[model samples]
Target: MSQSLQAAAQRLERWIKEDAIPLWLERGIDTETGVNIERLDVTGAVDREADIRVRVQARQAFFFAQAYDRGWCPQGKDVAQKMLQFVQQHAAHPTAGGGYTHLMNPHYEVIDSKQDLYDHAFFLLANAWSYRAFGDAAALAEADRLIAHLDKKFGAANGGWLEGDYAYACRRQNPHMHLFEAFLALYDATGNAKYLARTAELFALFQTRFFDESNGLLFEFFNDDWTRLADARGSWVEPGHMMEWVWLLDWYSRRSGRPVQAYLDALYARGLAIGQAPSGLLYDVVAENGDVVDTGKRCWGITELIKASLVQIRSGHPQAEAIAIKAVDDLFTYYLSASTAGSYVDRRGADDEVIVDVAPASTLYHLIVVAVELLDHCEGRVQAR
Candidate 1:
């Protein structure tokens, strides 16, 4: 590994060990609720009055699932198993649509019974990863159940998944992207065609509904009929999502050997063009017409951008050198230097002048992402040089 990347990876492992694992083991357990709490304030206290989002437990499952890949800690795997048990016992609810609810109270009781594609997608991701980590059949079964439900309820007549109902049926890129992510994990874990086929459907959905060939960037949202909801509905462009999709696409391309070079290049170009702010921090959303939607600097976008940049660089694009430098510099200034005890403050403006909040889990995961990718990129670039 290159020195720079090795440094990044070492930092990531330290943060995960010292910050994420211990904090969650102590505070996030939520003994009273039997599920993980969503928010822990800066004072290291849980918000007792805050409503729990079921998706948070799902996310924690994903965190532990990733332990296998990084190989830094074994406790994460144990924590993940405990978390899955908590979810199965407390958070899950049966809906009329034969799906699960998105909302739950602080006590782990169902608050909203309406089925949502967003919630289901995260569950699928968590379950898929959990199974991979522990070889647990129940987790795999739950993943398969969610996949079956997605196909049954969300699959469109024309061959793409639709967003499930809370109020109404709509189709959006968010769920499809995550579905692809979950399916990728399943495919890697089980070598199952069902998961691969689902991923293909999601890929087509992106090409048909989300990707804008005219501009080479993705549309933020869409309608049930796959019509462009061109207003603010389709306007919010998250650079993190763009970066994420790039990494995923590259992964798929490598696995399938499908020659996705053109698409990858375009994605990198679009992300760099729109995401970079004056301070070198990546923005959250750039409108469909290429306007900045959210100026607030979140660590998520920066980490994802680093991920994409590394993937592109390692995948044989030396041109990303300057881009990676700027990204690293900006990240250290805006995120890394300010981080405390594994948590990073969300910057409220373009210039990083205001601190909105500190979120540890999200920040820590991004740090891992950037670190691993940078490690890969540095190694690849060093060999090339």
Candidate 2:
């Protein structure tokens, strides 16, 4: 590694360990409910009135669990346990037979009781990490139960799980992508053949349904029968997701002994060609034809791009290290805050103005994962798959 990239990686490690994790652990939690607060204002004040999403809770749990595994935070395991308990107590539907509720008010009251596939994906992910962190068999058991519930309730006949009642109009590849991620985590945690099988199944679905072989892009929305949507509805694509799939496909290949170099090459090329704005930062959304849809940029997308770059570097892409370094620099320059040590501006408009002032708790997962990946690469822990 170059001296500059090494220094940047070290700086990100310090920021994540000393600033971000501590800030979130100190100020981002709701003491009354033992759940993470949804957001923190630029001044670092908790937004108590924000509606808590189940996905955020699960994300926080996953974050702390990973933190605990890395020895970054001493209380990470305890915090993960508290957050998981909160989910089990408050997020589960009272009368519904399966799946967790979608949203809750600040007071821990159920605001939306509908089951969402995205939310459940995170729930399973959290459990998988919790079990890995603390060796808690109950967490794995809960994950199994939730997986059973998902199969029973959200399973679609065509392939993949449905998006539930939330958006019955069209199916989404985003949720299935996440479920693919969760299944991978579960397989890692337990060496369960079933979870590995599910990962393979989701990968097949991605090849057939989500991935657009014509343009080398991944479509965001799909029809009920897993057909790509037409026109604007189907044309909308997120470069961040394409980048994310690059990372996931690489990981899947490493774990499953599957060869996905062709897929990675196509995704990386397409993401670089159509995913970036004029500024070189990854754009939020674009059409399949490469028209800019939403010029707004988000922190999560940038982090995913960094991850994809790192994966490419590990895979021996010639220019990938330079790309990864540039991504790290962009992340620090645009999204990360100067005054607020750990906080970030979540979104920026096309004009470079801040669209969202509050720092979302959900973004911690993205930041943490990027930092860890960079650190691993710099420290020679990442071996080429």
* Worst window of 10 by summed lDDT in candidate 2: 90-99
CA lDDT, candidate 2, residue 376: 87
Encode model 2's per-residue lDDT on 1-385: one tens digit a residue: 6887788789898998989988888898867667898998878888888898888989999999999999999899989999989888877877657668888898878899888888899989999999988998999999999989888878888999888756577888888999999999999899889999999999999999889887898988888888777758788889999999999998899888899988888898898898887666888998877888998989899899888988887778999888888888888888887467888889988976788878989999888888888888788886466
TM-score of each prediction: 0.89, 0.97
Q: What TM-score would candidate 1 get against the native? A: 0.89
Every candidate's CA RMSD: 3.1, 1.3
lDDT, candidates in the order shown: 0.69, 0.87
lDDT of 1 at 186: 87
Quality of model 1 by C-alpha lDDT: 0.69
